[model samples]
Target: MSPPGATRGQPAARSRRRAARVAAVAAGLLLALLLCEALGWPFLRGPVERAAARATASVVSIEAPFRVRFVFSPQLQAGRIVVAAAHGMALPHLVDAHALRADWRWGDIRRWRDGAPLRLEALRARTLDARLQRLADGRASWQLGQRRAPPAGEAALPRFGLLTLDEGHIEIDDHALALRATVDLSGSEGEGGRGIEARARGQYRGHDLDLRAHATAALPLLDESEQAPALPVRLEGKVGQVVLAFDGRAAALLTGRRLDGTLRMQGPSLAAVGAPLGLALPATPAFELVGRLAHDAGVWHLVAESATVGSSRLTGDFRYDGTREPGRLDGRLGGERLALADLGPAVGAPGTAAAPPPPGAPPPRVLPQREFDLPQLRGMDAEVQVAIAELDFGTEALAPVRQLRARVRLDDAVLRLEALSGVVGGGRVDGWSALDARQTPARWSVDLNFDRVAIDQWIRALRRGGAGDDPRRALLTGVLEGRLVLAGRGRSTAQILGSADGDGRLLLRRGTVSHLLTEAAGIDLAQALGVLVRGDEALPLRCARLEFGVEDGLVVPRVAVIDNRDSTVFVDGRASLADETLALRAQVRPKDFSVLSLRTPVLIGGHFSRPQVGLQASRLVGRAAAAIALGVLAAPLAALLPFVDPGSGDGPDPCTAAPRSAAAAAASAPRR
Candidate 1:
């Protein structure tokens, strides 16, 4: 039989066994808790969402419930994402995405522990839409205005291994830019792992646009070492009628080296590209271009293999450097038979359209009133050389050109046209002009020399609109040479012309002046002598010299003489540029006279808008003897001359190969 003490020992041993089992279970639970902490358990999603909300208070906010799920990886997600704007209004968000999710992969856990790169494997969103704006104050919604913590002292950026986007749409309505697009994204983990590809259909700058791009980088994308593989990239799109394609390899984005690319562009008009950007450029039809692009140290260089603008073909190299203040551009370009009017809009002149005057009042004058934006002029330095075989000016009012060459330099709002030379109206034309705009108002100066140009052609080329028909058109018929020097200060062309002061000279060779001019001016001796032959005859023009001084916006004739062997005529006048008025007196003497023996001076006075002529007998009261001597000499000479000779010349040609004005000769001297 068992003893009573033995039964009590059995029950105590059973209790000990149960106690040990409970202790073992508690130890297992403690181990599991430690693992969850290290792996970032989804149960902590509430804290993660709150931390995110605090970090992005200025840029974004979370409105929907935060939740976490465990799948292939731990994912923290939100139901609604709203971008934060000023005033704490979250209803109209800059960006709105739904079911946004992001997760760190298990593969990155070892790297995180080893101090290697910690990468987020995937970030995803569905039905995203965004808007970007720039205010008149120059503040931009897309730009991070808040100062970013310097990377020098901040933690490194976590690499984004993949991004998957679906049904994404974005609209950007900014002061200077506009875009609307639908975007799609995908990625893979093979040879192109860590690469994301995107396709977009949109409208940009008022043009239909489609774009596809692929980007891939070295394993550790932030590395700058020599062993890093070059980032591979490609872009293709259409902007308006222009089709653009680019294939290139480049340093990573933050490297500041945008280099190594082949670019192609073709379009019906280059203006299509510039118009959307508010750049002033004229139409260029049938344009095509190809170039190699490279950039290093903030300098971009483009070497054009071929380019065509309008009817001209061109080749050149262009460079822009922005590494230093006052960015610079240097280029050399040459073309043949270019339509210069295709570049007219770039001149920045305002259009002309005048309102009609009431009743018989004078016509309204059109003046340039466009505001000059000096900030753009002060931003860069430019040096360019251009050569063209022929430059078509696109109007009979402007001279046709040949062999045009120009060297242009712009520095700090000062523009200099150096070595500007061209052949126009069958003569060599050369000049230099300078415009200084560094001050509140601008100042300008011009010196021009025209050598042996046909006077008839020159007169035909002078435009007649606000200035009225050119009076010289009725008097000029042969080759002439002249010089003009002018200087003024103002912000616009009309103001400058009104304030200008200059000197000018003109020397004419063999030519003829219209008889109607002399008759209408009522010079009696000239009329009788012409009537001795016929009323329809033009007077022989042998030689003439016009020398004038400009001061206070008035052109004052110092010495004006027109002569042939039979008669000599002199004129004194002041033409007002400020008020467009004319005040002039003319005296004519016939070398010979008829029995009538009538002699009188003529007066011409009126606004240039409508000139008037009158006879001034009172002004000739004391010059009878001189008139008699002129009559006697002219009578004999008249018998020798024949009437109805419809040729250009009536006397010996006085024009020479050299410059006729001393001031012009000096101004035309070779530059040092």
Candidate 2:
């Protein structure tokens, strides 16, 4: 009111004072910042290292040349960080990194004030190389809680929304597996879409492996959909010589939930492809697979559209649930013309033909000579039913089988083959078998029943490639019916056979015996019987039956009888599986008598692999004594001679007595 400019001047002075006060505060903040920068005030160095150490369960250190940037935002950059392994000092170095940088943004600070989730802007590392190991004592380096308790919780956990790596590598050595790999990764938003890409080169279990993957998160992470976020992914890889490709959508990659895909795989051999994936296979078979695959939680399922193994084509639906140890495999596999030899190796049999033995060499042992790997049995649990329209053994091997079907179940180191049935050798074969692997070695039991098998066809097939001069070839023709029940405990075929105890029966009905028997028993019996026993053609085999029992590898005959129009023969013998030795006695009785018709009892004795036949002096002498005794009583017993006549022995039928005789033999056999 006194001067008009006075009020304005006073207001201007107040404004200048406020401006000066702001300037002073700004200067003070700048000075404080300078001091902090010099002293490395955030000394985040210690905290960062301790956090890393706690997270890795290891010792950690960061070599300094540390720097902090505060121009536009707070950031820290480091060089040459290392994390020590929790186990195995045998290694020269554990984990190392050339450069590490972390970015901080204002959004994170703002979110912290509102109690929202915290996120990092970026985390970038270059040339990081690390090794994770487990010692023989079961201590692991990559596993958490192995060293000390993580430093009091939440602070040690770093939440990074995005991570980038360049020229990075990691190696893992653990009890279950061994791995090493180089990795490169990048993610960014582009005109096309938001995508993450990764590439890896590695060796797994000594197999070369390569992988490429791309994933696009089509739905926003914060989208308010009740449905889970969908991540569409494409993958291509190779392990050894096997190639694999998959295109799929996953709910979450890390959690591996709700995964659906089409997977394609092809390789020269299943063995090579499955080696790295830990898929157990019996032999190196060429294989191809195309399947619709899915994963839910810990279970993986495959609907196989087409699968091929070797020359067999198969289609099946299979599942593997790895939610627990001794995980389960369930499937039904059906195919056409599966080769038994192809599966023979899985059961500890030779997968290929043996080299021919030298001339005059003894026949190969019946039991397997190769070692059996017992560990292959305890790898998993499975219930698979198999049906093959036909099964083939190579022409040079054995008879073909048809209508083969079986159900196989394996649980807790025990395997059962149930409801096994097939048609082979002109007969129906049915049986069940069980194998128990919980013992130090192993135990096995089997019951095989053969119904009315054509013995002549079996003989032809069995002797197809043998020497033509072999006297046993084509020597018998009959219908054979039998049952074999056996059990044993051992680690190998030989050991099992040595420990075997069983009963076996053979009944030959309405067939002929070849003239080779005449030579086998020596020409004396043939000439004594008649006209060289029906003129060198096979003799009429009226009836023949043999029964035996086994105990501790010894084979003892219960009853052996062979009858023909010309003569009757009986044999008693004991064979040793342990030593492959045999001792047998044969008594021949001619229907008609000539002075030359007097027959000497023949003996068959030697190793099974090299049996020998000759006349036995002791048996011949005993027969002569019996003849003399009969002559002394001939006049007094003339009226009853017809009852004791060898012809009278051939009653209505001899085979009628087979069952009773066989059962008696089995009941009397020594029990272990």
Candidate 3:
């Protein structure tokens, strides 16, 4: 019925039509699928629909992690959540998707604090809870740490705090917290940037801390707090102009663990933190402090540039490093001017002197007290120049102690006061002493060296007794020249042991030699100056060099003196310090130096002729008035003058305010 070629052509046409029909059907199916999706229909009505529902079920929010990777096509395939950025931030290890969706999803909040994060192995959540302080690069965190660093020299980086677990552990309130995290935070940052992040598993906080984390996004800060090892942090920087390295915890400190290291510091004047505290450590000649301090404990040192304590310009070096229990002071601190009228209260001195030192307390040492951590103190050595104000001496004459400097140290409560050379009462005093309070039974000792002291000057400083009282008699007048070296040690009154050596001539003019001079001299003078005699007229009496030696309780050579009028005065004396009485055996013309004023328990067994003299006290007059007056004195009408208050307790504080005297004001004229 058909040819071969015709048959072939017919089959081909049919095949072509079949292929076209199949293609049309496929296109229709695809269109149907797309339309269903747009119309919110389920493509895989059973399995796919159910799966999608379960996927988002109760999820409140999603916390995308940096580890997440995603590929979108006809079929979407996703890897783990990923965070990629350029910031200083640390993120978590894992997250519990279920838990995160339920309650822990972070809303649009900026800051988060006092929150714990639980990390998990699987992408899902578990039950382990790990609360870590997470910080972000923002202003909120930077403001939190600002409590100690203050806003004065304020500059900050966002930082977080996760105090040591040993500091203590926290208990939970509930499991309904608002914020939740399900993934680790990955990071990327610009130069010198920092960041943080973390994850939580089975996160459930209903009534827990309402941690608030809000801040400006562009800020930089410490974003994470891990369980880092407790180590001494050494900061290397400049403190004022001084370039110094501070050693950190060479010995055990935190929890008795020694962290050894060094932190170098160098800075401008405003940068020296310690300088403001009053320990004036040496710095560049520009009033800048530059030094290195190494401490064992996590402690801060103190310093001062120019601080005034009760009118005393305390400008010196003082350091305290607390390592041991009692601590240690390695260097010395002294000032040019001095002021401590309330010394009894200022330096822990109890009210009444008669109240007696604490049982057997050693005399006051010039060193600071042993109270704080020992090794924490920094050593000091500074030179301070200052001026002093007026103070009470004895009589109406003001007492001024000027141009004074001292080197002091306190090691384990054993304070050593040395280089205690000062000009007082117009005299030079040298030598030092020790106060061993380290032991339960405190002890004391001192070695004093005195130079030429004009005796008459000292008497004028005392408060007058009465209007009719002996005015000239007030002058324990004498050309007191010699080295009066006294060395002694004592614990209590009965335990006192020491001796004194006085080698010099006691010149008496218009004074009683027997009463004032204890060198076996018995010359009774009405008025004494550089001479001693009995008549009211001013007479001069010269006494031979006096010498006395005491071994335990026994006295040798009793007393002996040569008078100016070619008179030899000798007296034997016995003493009972506890009784406070003295007996005399001698003659001063008429009254025969008999028992003088017998105030102390002493017996005299020496004789003397009538020499120019007047009976008086043993503490001779001194030219102290000149030596103690360091600065210029105010005029009699100074109190009424500009900026001058003669009665003001606090005199001029050159380091701070202006002067109180007209003359001082004139001297302090501001220069252009």
Candidate 4:
């Protein structure tokens, strides 16, 4: 069926052919491997070692820090290095960057200035021991150098460019010591142009500070192919204190040299401490602040959104430039109930002696010599704003003066209070005023307006502190309108004694004089008056020119009542503070003049709150008709009496001589 030889050797031939196929396959694989080796890994021979050695020469010098251990890969390594440990060196020793490995990608060789871009790889080394500086000074000697003089015509040697690790650290201190960032390092190559960039973020020292930041820059020498367009960076940190809490952020365009960002810090409570006046502080007085802050070169600016100072709200803007002995501010401040204490921290006042940035921050920006003067108030450049729901002059008067509130704003040696409304002396006081905080000894003035007020209403209020609780007294109704205008200079209450000269009047209505002038002017116990006067006996006892005095000292008006015709009567003669009584020199002018029996000088001292007066004779006027009836009956009785007399007989108006004579004769025998 088949040829003899073809058929007989067929099996052998198949075997040989299969063997050949296997050999061919092996050859092809070997060829592929060889080709791959040639192109895939170009520097697999002594070339790599040679290149490494050349690259090492490019490093000016490597400073192996203390306690550093470097490890290298056996197959692909430049060289192994180990740093010595630092035992006790006072001069801060940074990073144990001892052991390290690097493969110079591009090397200065056989005049290869113009050619394809050179690249280097496998550029790394690991270390187990790495300890460095705790904190970075924020200032540095750029390892690269100062900006290179601008190229004469451009096309300078491709500016050098690189990215490398600098150092790392972690630390803690009083307020908050910071740790070093994993600073990435970068530099440029070539003449006339140079650039650099580095960035890193981490929790330094494994137990110190928290920080994250990045920076980058480039020199003009960077070849277009190796250059990035821009370098942008951001930084953040946190601060903690017993009385303060803080966190901040900052962002900048590194290459452009422009910065913009914000910072915020907050705490609870603070105290006002200075020479002259001292104040005790409290805890839980929450104070917080958030600022839209920025810094460029040495200039700084801030705008606070909102803050808390002792349960109060504050907001404003602030700015400063450079390290001047006296810094200046152009801003405004406002708050609801904040005190001067709570504002210390925000305004850069000395809050705590120890805090972050070490007392080393060039000493707080010099405070400027700023001043503010307003018609109503005067203050230092350091101004204040205050709002209060209630305040106690801490004196005895109306009980819980209701609806009491006020607002005060101070600035540049000027103090202005727009609203000061409250209940005083049974009347509502609504007004505004100003003070000169800068004037020698400071000057003050206020214009107060009073509203229609009830006397008994005030009396009852005062009575609460007195011993009299009379029911009839409760029925009393009276209104008083008055003015209290005064101006003077005084730093304290003691100064106000003689510093002020002012006048005030009391207008009365629908009330009895006994109620108003009971303690002031000795008056009719039962007469009601349409009006009355006050002020006099104490000072000059003038209805209009009433004067007051100071004892320990409190300025009090001498009691006097001036009638509508300006007729003034002394209620209490030369009265003075007598413990709790308005001692009156007994002088009584009664409805029906009654001579004094108490003494030539009666002491009419009693709680003016309520005085007892008895006049039963005056009440008799209510029964005038009864007395008239009795008088009428007595007239007729007189006629009968005359007739009964006989001798003086009462006959009809006729000539009574005869009758009289007869009567007289009858009377002569009329012994009976």
Which prediction has more favorable lDDT, 3 or 4?
4
Order of models, best TM-score first:
2, 1, 3, 4
Query: Model 3: runs farther than 4 Å from truth?
Result: 1-299, 305-313, 323-349, 352-399, 411-414, 436-443, 461-474, 484-537, 553-562, 566-672
Per-residue alpha-carbon lDDT of candidate 1 for residues 1-672, written as tens digits (9 for 90 to 100): 699999889989888887778777777766665566455464565565565445444455554556554455666567777665432433266667788776776657556545443466665677666554444444444322222322221223335455555545544343333555555545432354666565657676677777676666322222222333456767677766777776886653223245578978887666675444333224555678898877766687878788887656777787878665777878987766676545533333432224557888974444343444445566678888978787776556555678888887888779888898888767878899988888667887899888987666655633223114553444445567889899877776656666788888888776776654544343443454655576544566777778777766766776677765446666766666767666777766555443333345666777765777776655444454445565577885453232211222334432222323434423332221
lDDT of 3 by residue, 538-593 (tens): 22444334434434422232233434332334433333222222334333322222
Q: What's the residue-level lDDT of 344 in candidate 4? A: 41
**Model 4, residue 47: displacement in angstroms?**
22
TM-scores of the models, in the order given:
0.60, 0.65, 0.37, 0.37
For model 1, the run of ten residues with the poorest summed lDDT: 640-649
What's the true lDDT of residue 619 in model 1? Answer: 42
Best by lDDT: 2
After superposition on all C-alphas, the RMSD of every candidate to the true structure, in Å, is 10.7, 8.8, 21.2, 23.7
RMSD of 4: 23.7
Backbone clashes in candidate 3 total: 131
Cα lDDT for residue 325, model 4?
A: 31
Ten contiguous residues with the weakest lDDT in model 3? 212-221
lDDT of 2: 0.64
True-vs-predicted CA distance for residue 205, candidate 3, Å: 38
**Model 4, range 450-478, lDDT digits (tens) per residue?**
67665555555434234254423332335
* Clashes, model 4: 41
Model 3 Cα shift for residue 240 (angstroms): 31
Tens digits of per-residue lDDT, candidate 2, 1-672, equal 469888779989998999999998889899888877765555767877786576555677887767766557667677877767554356545667778776778777466434433346665677666565554454545433344322221111123445556555555454334555554555542235457565657776778868777765321121112245456778788877889888987653322446688989888765565466454445535678998889776687888788887666777787878766767878887767786556655555665667877998876665664555566567678888888788776554355677888998988888899999988768888999988888776888899888877776654543425524333445676778888888877877667777778888778886777654643453344353554555555777888888777788777777677777656676766676766666777776555433333355667786665687777676456656666666677764442332232322344454455443444644543222
